[model samples]
Target: MFSTREQKLLRYLMQTEKEMTGLELAGHLHITSRTIRSMIKNLTAILEEHGAEIIARHRKGYQLHIHDHSAFRSFLKIVAFERVNEQWIPSDPSDRIAFLIKRLLLSEDYIKLEMLADELYVSSSTVKNSLKEVRELLTKYELVVDSRPNYGLKVVGNELKMRFCIAEYVFNSAQKTTELVADPEMAAIRSIILKQTKRAGIQLSDIGLSNLVIHIAIACKRVLLHNYVSMLDEEIKNFEEQAEYLVSRQIVTDIEKSFNVTFPNSEVAYVTLHLLGTKMVSYRKASDALSPVNLVSEEILTLTANLIDQVENELQLGIHDDQELINGLGMHLKPAINRHYYGMNIRNPLLAEIKQKYPLAFDAGVVMSNALHDSLGVHINEDEIGYLALHIEAAMERKRLKPKTKRCVIVCATGVASSQLLYYKLKSAFESHLDIAGTMNLYELRNYPLESLDFIISTIPIYDDLSIPVVEVNTLLGNQDILHIEAYMVDHITLVLDYTDPELMYFQKDLQTREEVFDFFEAELTKLGRIPAGFKEAVIEREKVSPTCYGNLVAIPHPMRPLTKETFWSVLTLKKPIAWGDEMVQYICLLSVQKEYEDEMQKIYQFLVKVIETKALVDQLIKIERYADFEQVIKRMEEYGSR
Candidate 1:
């Protein structure tokens, strides 16, 4: 029911809890101030019907206010399904870029820019700008856009490169992305694929199944157009013996009968390639659990172990013994290795969020990536690393919660009855996480052996210096007192980063490309003697491994390894956004660390993750022209994010 701009505006408003200014919205949507105002008026008109209205205030911008929550929710549901039922066209630059790429990729003939502009409801000049971005995106897939003056523009490249580009942009976009597909058609394909995969003893999650369905649908469409993908005789011979190939054949055979289309061996091979990327070992019964080792290959298992060991060597996460992690990583890596062998591309939608929230885990994933590169010769992209980080995160969670209780001694200055009451209160509060070692008086605290206990909970003022932390509580403890004791019992992983120096912060700097921004930072830092001679090269090398641009208009570029004598972060906010490895970035944080440092950096990483996670915070940081304002905004965000 809404235009593309309206949809994007609604989505942005929904994502932010605080009020957003028109200027902030304009920056994020890449539209002008006047265009933002016009779009907001249009959006408000549509939203009023659903009991929702955009509330505008002086100096505070606009926010969505709902008159009836139930009605607003119903409106959202309708919009979601409408996307599938109605013909949807992109209204924003990002979506339009994707649309243009898919259109150019699938079109048999050249498409005229005037026709594109007409269809998209944009000006000819806007279309031209979108095409430039399209050309940049195509370069990643090794594809090119060939433009002629009289005729128009068409995507031109190798047949294999074209297919890969289609697989990445067109098909992958359909897999749980914003692109809409007919529900009935999507559901039918998923059901058919599920039946075939189940019959073959291959397991896939719902999202994975949907992804496969899209791949098959693309393959079918391309085959009908006589745009078949063919592998060499050696590759085809090797694929014929694969179990996944047989499963793919069965799936294609049923699809052919239902869709009234015939698929050749090459098409079947193409389907098998997708299968190899997605198939997982089915869960076995407890009786057959001991034979689970036979599910995945020994090579993959060995590689998984090596990867875990590498992470352990780097971060010491202590997840190498987690069998579930080992199994999950092994299963994931099997298909990943297959993809590398054939140079296939896979996308992870959660990659950005994973990098933002789990920076330490992502760092460990980088270590695992290097190990995989050395052993399997497969270069790991950030998307694949995100999946690996998920497994590592799960293992860390398990390790943190493994039935281990803390031992503590409670010291009481009052009578035995009060001490007993405090003891019962502590037990009720901590539950399973704490074990009361014994109760002791303040006089007995001097002779008390505190080495065996994790921490001491005291009822009276005992100022004796001790190795273990001491929590002072009242004779009759309240909720706050219990919480205070629990704080010592629970190891807080929340990192409130306090590393942004006032001198290192640069505001509203005019920078162009990724290279230009890095160059500016290098020149500034080098002039101040803050970094080594090879610091810039170290940062560039890290980019070669993977771009540090983690989306949300933020990029935290750091060297592959520590290259500085001191650990510090140099931050710069650009006045205008620039292209940074397939994404637009404005806020840049150049991270540097001393070599062979032993400090725990979970807190610092958490802080950086917070910056990456919040769009409003980034908006606030961008508008700030002074270091004091920047620091104030960060402090405000820290307070808000904690809430």
Candidate 2:
């Protein structure tokens, strides 16, 4: 079997298509270049028989060449199975953190750093550095790593918090639940939970089921260790009155019989909390979807309505009236609020993918969270925000699937006959795409309901400023006129380049940190009088909610709310990548949207999302030194988006 470092090197090579130099590998592995070379030599010898080999280029790097696909597949399966069967060891800093967390959580006495270092086969300094990240992780659970003069380190926190941390860091570290516990034991626990939930007519998602099973398994283990969850007398009384308490009791009774262990009332109440937190609504009729259920209170309904209103008013996503979204969000918030009240953290495995793919919806989710905080005084974490975004994204998809007919009113200075002729011509050309609200003369145009119209197709030029767009066309409605109106009807980019300014594009900058980037932006924008006084602070506050780094070497930093009077993007490309939150970014687009242009934010984000999702474009843009090249790339992005 390959060593942990060798296996990690192989996995890294398999992940990327580009060749990696020895220096780069050494940096990633936190080892010397000489050591990387030695490891590469040893790996090459082993992989030659396994249908893969490492080819070292003169100056470029080393690339993995896989020649025998069948042999490679069998070799990978054997390696994976062997790794799963054998005792796991820490290979990297992340793995070491998990290992240390599990060790600290399980050990009754304080463990020395030297002892951990020996277990990890690393130096004490390495263990100390890994502990910094461990401390950060533990802090999220209200856990602290206490150090004593003679004793080394121990995790100290609320019993409930410690159990929650242990459930995540220890039991969840393995890919399969059976790996953490005996296969039959896990199966029995899972079967009991499923049977009880089904009998109670309670619904649980796949992730919810897994979490419940893991927490129950952890409870059983902790009970064996003489540790039990404690609750206030009033809290237990309140829990007992709930329906889930009875269900929890039934589950505990069955498990006690199967495992030959008894659960205290506090443990039963703890299980009831999990049940309440993971509860899902199974059915809702479409006619009265928004009608409040037993769990959904009037306060939750009001908050849900406000959130939908805020999203619609701010983004104009056309999903505020979506009944399914209203129902889904209301149902989701009930259990979500329960989780928050109990200080339970629900893990969202799709948070990263949601942020990357559904950025606009995720931003809408952020808006909803802010509104929720204002109304309920509860801070919704990123995981809950991600789940909220899924519902919003689904609504967005539903809206997209429906035909988006553009509404317009035809205006002409000529008599009714000419206006009527022009209306029919437009209808004939775009019957399915355009919804002609009405035809009227120029004098009657003032009385028209402009709010309901998307644009005005006028035969004569109407110089009066209007809220919606105006497309001037001949009475005959020429081909060019048809194309002009088509731009409004189709989902085409209406000059996305208008949001980008040449003066704001900075290339190959020497900024080394996020603060430096903000400083440079502030100095330049302030000189041009483009930003408000507290623009940088607002952007930093938004970052605290969630980092703007969406991967592909790009980060789009913006204020929490609109603070600029004009909508525009300030682009910056660095000479080298800088740390932005957890990801490294070389391309930065500082966005400042005008409050009046909030409706256009979705379109603006779509353009930025394209830049984030396309790696080749980011790589090309970061390497360019001229604004002309950058402009061309943006233009290409616009062209691609229009299609």
Candidate 3:
């Protein structure tokens, strides 16, 4: 499956390729113009790598003008292996004798050849050939294949070692179909991932994407193996070095080739570091109770990932927040019973916090983890090491990030009373909690760089885009809302340390997801089959107050909208910019606010300004053919809120 990074780039290219200017490309890719230029150069080189050409013009940027696209397509067709591994159910009997050998290697206690053949979806003969191939494949490991007429086939060797061999064979065979589809989305994601890999000067597909996944998997597995290590000193040293090699190389390029996906070295090393962290966390105080070596057979590593997939059928859980599902997952692994006994619960709070605060990250991690779980028995959550790795990963988000310092930009219409009240109140709330960055008055909102402010609490209205998460409140700062704000402050205490710290919100995500405008409609109207709660009331309230029609057919629709620290925006199009009675509105924008505050109103105004700035981009949405692309436009508009 395409990774989030690859898929996002593909969608971006699909959206903006109509104009495809270097500037446009840079904007869509969220990269520097220089990076896009280098990407074009590297993209051209890779096309040439395949004996194709990427055509470019002065202003037009670049296009993959296939010299011979069909030639590359031909390279993807699978060549039938003569000695296909036993785990493979071959189509024909070219190596039928190898089937028993393959069967012998794979069968645990009994060689249930009939059962194996059925599971493989092959006839007994085809299964037989695969078995023969398995035997030949394992022969080099000093393994011999033998069968019992009563029990089925069995491989007599270092059983664990032979199992690893079988796993390697099965994994490679299964990934034979891992080529790009002609679908534009898949093509784009593939191109982005492959291109990034090549640009970093990493060999992607040549080494194979599966191999890369394996390499990383091995690194993760090594950590898992570390806790279970029972070998003599030499073996222990070898294990340590092998794990270190993955980190020191600063690249999982070899593994990337196997998957044709680019994984950053820093991220890879962090995985190692985090696994180490989790191992420390799980065994808190070393225990005298020791479990024997529960060997991670390559087959089990690869296979068990599938069997447990029955969880969907068994538990009837659809994936929403994967991290939450994963919090209790250590119970699943066969070898790591200690994890079942001790690991899952202790780290759950961190996972809960990660899921709450970093919603985007939480969602992505869950989806990818579950997707991998579904496809391969790669139970990432089972590896508590990966959990610690994510924390370290988030911790490593910024290089040389300033420590828990505060940058508070406070605002009130009249700076003396309400604004000062907010300032002092905020100071009381956060002074001991955060490194205060700075504060602001209503008039200064237009001048401060949004990123410079850590928090914005304003009374009355304000208009500059502060680039910080703005919290809108009332001027009086009453007891109820103060209680609410207190709850909010208490919930996000960790964010004071790291803005992106996943633990910032703890378990309060459910409460806040409701603040969203779309959700208000869905929960109140759609779900209850009842009259809407806040939205309809807002519309009536606005209509009663002389209609918020701003002449140009533009109007703001909102309920008393309640006081919220959140902002929401939605759009509508007129066949023509119509007049609201006497006034013409070429465009209309609306906001639901926490209170009638200058700072909150200003944020809505700034959002409009951005929409106007990107007028050209907004217009292109009219031409978009697909629902998916249209939805992407909405998502991109939301990202504007992030920036």
In order, the Cα lDDT scores of the candidates are 0.77, 0.83, 0.41
lDDT of 3 by residue, 1-643 (tens): 1122232343455344344666555444434456566655644554465545556677756554445767644522222232122233433343234334444543446667787677556678767656766667667565766667867766676532443444344333323322112234334434543444443333222223333333334333333333121235553444345333343233345435544555443334433332222221122112322222122334433433343243232222232223323332322232223223222111232543332233222323333345445564444441233343253234324311423444456666665665667667666755665534445666677776766555666665555554566667777776664555444342231221221121111111112111242344435333533334456655554344233333212334445333333334434333333334223333333344433233233334434434445546545543444435545665577655545
**Better candidate number, 1 or 2, judged by lDDT:** 2
Reference-based TM-score of each model: 0.72, 0.83, 0.27
Q: How many backbone collisions does model 1 have? A: 0
lDDT of 2: 0.83
Shift in Å, residue 170, candidate 3: 15
**The best candidate in terms of TM-score:** 2
What TM-score should be assigned to candidate 2?
Answer: 0.83
Every candidate's CA RMSD: 6.9, 5.0, 25.4
- Ordered by TM-score, highest first, the candidates read 2, 1, 3
Best by lDDT: 2
- The lowest-lDDT stretch of 10 consecutive residues in candidate 3 is 499-508
Please estimate how well model 1 matches the true structure, expressed as its whole-model Cα lDDT. 0.77
Residue 534 of model 1 has an lDDT of 84
Query: How do the residues 19-68 of candidate 2 rate in per-residue lDDT, one tens digit apiece?
Result: 99775675455455677888898889889998999999989999999999
